[model samples]
Target: MTLVNTMEYNKDDLLDKVQEDAENLFRSGTYFCSEAVLQTINELLGKPYDENIVKLASGFPIGMGKAQCLCGAVSGGQMGLGIVYGRVEGEPMKDKMFDVSKKLHDYIIDEYKSTCCRVITRKWQGDDFKSPERKEHCITITGMVARWVANELIEDNKIQVGR
Candidate 1:
């Protein structure tokens, strides 16, 4: 559904709704890790998940595969936060973006209990050789991270919460 139509909120209620929507997005997907995150951001922000955001975030999974640092899902969550609260030139509200991003990151880390990619992927990591389990794990983790970030943003009053 379009966020504008689906969203109903006063200033106090937006975050909870956004977090709920984010969790719903994650649970609904079997795959679509990156796309689902982008979609969640759009829904939470009451914007559209257009091609540009997708293209910019396309490199996330590749980065995860190469860097082997944080999980791609977590990266996707960070990217979504950046997209919604990112700083821009001449924007008087730029400082808020950093605080918001930090809060989101901290919340995800706390919720997941670990930020290490290997740790997060440990459950699905195996020598199966071409098993789809790894991808599924990544997708699930992505959803979790998305939910946490959405929750933080909402709770922190960084975004408009919806009913």
Candidate 2:
């Protein structure tokens, strides 16, 4: 645990919060998979960009508007990585941005066999997208992706745990 503002901040707690918030946000319909992940990470990072920065990830849900190409959660994870490692004017670019992005892709692919939304959700093909099982699966992925990014941030020292 690290002390922040005189309070003990536990890294494990932060990771749990990231996962819970991301899952709840999606379950509450406040945001889709991508938006939830984006929103959760942005807040975790202290809102570095504008409040509406999550808009950048809006179109990524449902595998790019139901096209079912890339996993929406993965897309959101990539955006989260960019928010931390993105290139800025007059600032040196972060090489870890590319490295982490690819790592996320590879991680998802390794776990799901493909990063495509349709592929990840293949077990729900005949079921309604809004079905509880399908929703739970997506919600689980959203939470996992958010936690993964938070863990990476902690490991990279980009975020001070117990902040």
Candidate 3:
């Protein structure tokens, strides 16, 4: 059965469903920061969970020591924006994608006050991954980021209609 039929959901109920889905995804092995954000966006947009997106996000893990230039949450938001507003070669909307990315970046930074992993996890810099406090903080912040993205996309009418 389709997700809509199984859940008996209308557009108005999407946010709660998305939040629940995001929490579930987080509890699952897909705890990578970016996956949480992507899952939330997919659920909000009524898109089926895509493995490719998860796989792409798996590459980003602050605790894993990747220490990639971009924050995982920001990367996830950009990915979501790409899915929603990106374009192929010579396709229109390239500029729109950049604009949307900027918006997502601004939103993330505004919420967290800083996008740097080091800044966000100053309490456990070298071993934050090993501490329960730090782990919980990561989970909480990631969830907050996911919820913020969902709220923004929904408010801005960026989510596709009739998914």
lDDT of 1 by residue, 7-111 (tens): 456543444444445445545642245556666766666664564565555555523554556655666777787776775688666676777667656765786
Top-TM-score candidate index: 2
Q: What are the Cα lDDT values of the candidates?
A: 0.59, 0.86, 0.63
What does the lDDT read for residue 158 in candidate 2?
Answer: 80
lDDT of 2 at 137: 95
What's the lDDT for candidate 3?
Answer: 0.63
Candidate 2 RMSD to the real structure: 3.2
TM-score of each: 0.66, 0.90, 0.75
TM-score of 2: 0.90
TM-score of 1: 0.66
Highest lDDT: which candidate? 2
Error of 3 at 115 (Å): 0.9
| Worst-scoring 10-residue span by lDDT in model 3 | 1-10
**Candidate 2 local lDDT, residue 140:** 97
lDDT head-to-head 1 vs 2, winner? 2
Q: Can you give the lDDT of residue 155 in candidate 1?
A: 65
